[model samples]
Target: MSLSETQPDAAGARRIARPVPLRESVYSAILDMIVSRNLQPGQHLVESELALMLGVSRQPVREALQWLKNDGWVDLRPGLGAYVHTPTVEEADQLLAVRRLLETESARLAAQHATEEGVEHLRELCRQGFAALEAEDVATMVALNAELHATVMRLSRNDVLVELASQVDRRVRWYYTPVARHRGAQSWTEHSALIDAIAAGDGDRAGEVMHAHTEHTRLSYLEQQNLEKSGADAGSPARPITGRRP
Candidate 1:
């Protein structure tokens, strides 16, 4: 029998259903691997192995690796394939500094320009974030956390500011994914304060709160690092932060 004639229509239908778009699928797969710590910083990405694991062609994997390189999540090395990028303490500090400046300005603008509808949306986002936290849905909480920040940036209505904030948001997420569980209720409490400030339309207060929040994140990261180092010195397992799957 011919191949077509041997196969039932339903069987063929299942096999011929379109696959996910190559670029997007590969991007998401690699991102998830990175977030989950399956691809640790400085770990090499072997194209053939990744292609086999992802069940796709090397072309798509290569394209995704290039995109990740541009995002500062991977480093492309000549003859050595791509390696995951690690943020140094210095780099983290610099990023947090920039984030504080940009986000605080964004919050100030959001307070001034956010319409009633925008404020309501922000409130809903905060509510959902807290609910997710209460339920111990770390993934949902992380997603909502990004949504809340993005919504505020949109309300700001400054294209340049929004773009900067978007970049910072990605880095911030990478930082948070590892530490979200440890942060626990404190994170949501800060979000509540931020929401209250924004809802009150107090631009100066909103900016101040945002600035403090960013600084608080920086401090927490620093403390975590210190704790890890101390633990190592004391001969305990160096509980390094572990990221979530994307």
Candidate 2:
């Protein structure tokens, strides 16, 4: 029943799928830690410690660290080892703007193509998100928010758009994790409107709703940065792209 045990061979016979290598698994683990802020910005990454913590060998850890460096997630100093990359305001803004563009298009497409079942599914997700909000479960709210967006992307039914969105997805999660709690009720309210537009099959309305919804998040992040700047007068620097574990 495992993915690695269920793949079909070239001749169409069943064969074990090649299991993912340890190095790739380690890479994914480290990436999750970074995205969740368990490995914070500028925090030193000790390979031996990470290997031990992850119950893996140093070889895979080393390989994963190198991969992280290539992906701009971890910085490897010439002699000082590795550290998590400190996300900048400019970087966050740029990435978020890209997400907004992609999601707006997705909303438009979803409205054009949405089925009744798909719209109902979106509404169910919206309800779950609201319930999470009511429970003040930021983690669940954040996850449900992601699922809602992903469902919209799927409903869009554009492989090219989905591919482009996939590229930006993790980065978007990294940025949004910090602001999720702050987004609160208004975020779900907007999701409701977006669902309504899709249900109505109003592509223009769907796009408009998504555009505004994404802009709210962007503005909120900017405002958060501004607040941090205000507080930095006492010498505490603004730390952008914070995360919390679910």
lDDT of 2: 0.88
**Over all chains combined, what TM-score does candidate 1 have?**
0.79
92-208 in candidate 1: lDDT tens per residue? 888878988888898998888888898888888888877877787777777787888888889889999988887677678777666677776887788778777888889999899
RMSD of each: 8.7, 4.8
Stretches of candidate 1 above 4 Å error?
1-25, 35-38, 76-81, 232-240, 243-246
Candidate 1 positional error at 84, Å = 1.7
Q: What residue pairs are clashing in model 1?
A: none
Clashes of 2: 1
CA lDDT scores, all candidates in order: 0.81, 0.88
Shift of residue 134 alpha carbon in model 1, Å: 1.7
